[model samples]
Target chain A: MIPHDEGNGTSKPHAPRIGVVFGHPSRQYAPGEELVVRYDVEGVELPAIRAMERTVVWYTEGKGEEDLGVHRFERIDDLAGLAEALPHGTITACLPASPLSYEGVIVKIRWCVRIRLFFVAGRDFVSEHVFEIGAIAPARGVVERVQ
Target chain B: MRLPPFFGKKRGHRRTGSQAWGSFGEAVFYAALVAAGLCFAGLLLTGAVGIGPESAAPGWMRGWLWIFIWLIPGALLAFGVAGVARTVRDWGKSEERRAAAEGLGTLLESMGQSPAAQHPFPGVPACDDLVNSPGTILRYRLPIESPESWTLVGMGLFAGLWNAVLVVLAVSAGIDIASGRIEWVLLAVLVPFVLIGVTGIVIFIRRLVLTTAVGTTQLEICDHPLLPESSYDVLLAQSGSGMLRSLVLTLEIEEMASFRQGTDTRTERVIVWRDIVKEWTNLEITPGVRFETHVTVAIPAGAMHSFGSGHNAVRWRLVVRGQPERWPGFVRVFPVVVHPAPPAESAAVRHGATADGVPG
Candidate 1:
């Protein structure tokens, strides 16, 4: 469905609403279980990692494997704080970055979430729904904003 | 006129990945050029913002050197990328076709004719493959365009960067001499780069012409002959594609000696390959695009007495078909030899009729 409202009970007139979804949980992740961080970003469709639980160790790209950022999400405050810091159109659930808690479960996994943004159409005479990323299978977590 | 659909309504060219070497290497080459442009821009801006007047004389001399260093490499990168992308795109289209041919299988068989074929909205060419490739669903491909213009543009960008760097070097040197800035001393060493850029600009112009592929149909002697008897070396070399399989290949020979003894040379004949040239090939890549073809013919040489140089004589003839437009269904023929081959013996035995003693 085309979601028009952000997760925090807010909506913008011109902006497209963003949402994420996890797959039917496929295989196991690296050292820890997979963690998927989603954001129902409105009026814009972009994704980026705002913060991590620990200092950045390393990241790489390969087939059947993706190394996302390692972040500690101790409380909800850290998640919201980092989310607000990121540029609107850059960070999203589908992007390579995510927020994590220090005391809570470590969120370090690639997103299998397909974030689609729905915006009001202009002269095109059709509502615009764009997938922020291609097919992704999120292993865990709810849709939360980086801020 | 459209040829018969024997080869099927040929879709746009597809990549067979059959290209063992294509724009892929050139892609890397262009990407590296983009990087070089960025690096040169950075260096130019640095030299332009140099420290002041105290170091004018030394700084001025150094600035010229940096301009040369920065200009040539940067320009080469620009032209290489600009020109390479166009050629690569053409090649990729060929590969894409290859991918589609096998990818669609029987479903693609009745494209324009079958009722089950996936047809786009009102368009030309009757059929369209737009399910996977959203782009170019309805457009005629213009074959007359060339990407050489991009090379010239890239050269222009490189020139601007070089000039910018030169000015920066000049300004920074003047500033350092007047203000006696110590850090500005580092800026003076860039004079040589300026010189290289000037020289590079000229070299790049020559290189661009050498590399571009103009769609010209040129076939020349394989090698230049030092003597009248040049071993009859002939090879057909061209850099463009789009020749049809049924094309009438005409090879005109002009040399000291020529002879055909066996099927080796005659089979390969100076004729266009009717089966191999225009292929609807595809198999996860462009079909094998290259084939190493060669043929050797035994040329009968005269006693070397007819010609003044006691050398053999080979004449050249231009071959043309009567029906030029009705391509493919054609024939290949050579100029008549001055002396004809001996008449063949009749196979039919003279059982009834005789020449003189028997019944007529």
Candidate 2:
């Protein structure tokens, strides 16, 4: 549930929103295992041009210089779903043997699935949601809500 | 290219730390120089020209005395000067002598050279004073543990008190001279005081310079989850003000092996792979300028991927060192992760391609 607006109660403008979720809601996977990704685009004009792409990458966020590695990139173009539709489908791909996510005093490695929407007039938006790969997996699925 | 593991059991190089023998040798050599200078001054003060009154000595004896007096002081002065010159020429040349001479050599080189050429940032002037140096501003300091710690502790107190005493004596002498109560002959007696004051001032300046001359560096990689046999771009940057004698960037992949030692578990870091990625020498940096370079590092295809569990792991890191001419150099490490290359696909097994020829 969204929190109540601050005092004075002037609501902010509604902007386009997109949501992404894994098929199994699993935040962890192993090498050579197939996993599915699902996406939802909402709150925008119907028949809007968009591209849905899947990417596997590792990145750093602290201390030393930031680094990134792209493991996979697959794009689905002409995503012509209606505004009320969730536009959800299963995307299957095998995981590559990789640097497991790690956190250290001077370094941090994060793995994530990022969706970027490119619109006219240079109004491109990017959102990154992190996941895990390797033997270490969380005990429960992490539920991420879309606005 | 596929290669064996870069991590190994042997240590690669000695980067920092003091050596006992080198320090002792330096102390002895410096003492010898001081002794020679003092002896030469002593001989001159005792009247090196004529041993006695004009008629009190034979002509041959007087000539011999003149030779002894001049020869002793001349030989001593020559020895001291030659020793200093040799030291300057051989500065930071050997590994064994590297640590002890590291601080002094850098400090002297920066003090001697003019300001660095280009600024790191545009429109900002280079630093002309140590107090406003870039290195000092970029790096954090801990109390009493810096490279100059020992030198400061050794001479700081004595130099401060000695300078104070010299100031007091000079002021008193000046008052007496202005009042016309002191003889000009007594003014000659201040020569020893002047020498002592000079020594105190030099030591005090050295302590200040050393305290302000330490440098810091950083490394940024363009990509992470690095793949074997893939080239990754990297940026190396260093911060310091003054003359930089050398800067070296090294990429090291170490194997962290864990084993049972008696009842305890022990982990040992062995550097199995090492490479010198880049080096820059004879650079001058001002306050607005920093040392930065771009380089690429390739991971071997056969190299092991980074792994971590309850017991063992393999790790990779980039090490950057900045050796300033007259200040303390620094070494910084940036850790990285390596991933194994994906398995090659077979001829007929296309996973996601449809008849329309589009990727899923």
> Against the true structure, whose DockQ is highest?
2
lDDT of 2 by residue, B152-259 (tens): 666777777777877787788899989979866556767787787788779777666755564445555544445555665666666668887887777665544445
Residue by residue across B1-360, what tens digits does model 1's lDDT show?
A: 222222322111121222223345567777777787777677667765333355555766767756666676578677877866766556523222332343356345547565655432110122121112221211111121123445567876786688688778877777877897655445656667677677667756654543332223222222211111112222222232333332223423322222234543211112111111121222111122422122211112210101101112222222322121222222222221111111232222222211121110
User: What DockQ results for candidate 2?
Assistant: 0.02
Which whole-number lDDT from 0 to 100 does residue B155 have in model 2? Answer: 77
Q: Give the candidate number with the greatest lDDT.
A: 2
Model 2 docking category:
incorrect
Model 1 ranges off by over 4 Å: A1-147, B1-141, B144-152, B178-184, B208-360
Q: After superposition, which runs of candidate 2 have C-alpha atoms over 4 Å from their true positions? A: A1-147, B1-212, B258-266, B345-360
Q: What are the RMSD figures for all models against the true structure?
A: 29.8, 29.2
True contacts kept of each: 0.00, 0.03
Q: Tens digits of per-residue lDDT for model 1 on A29-83?
A: 2222333433344443223332211111211111112222222212111546545
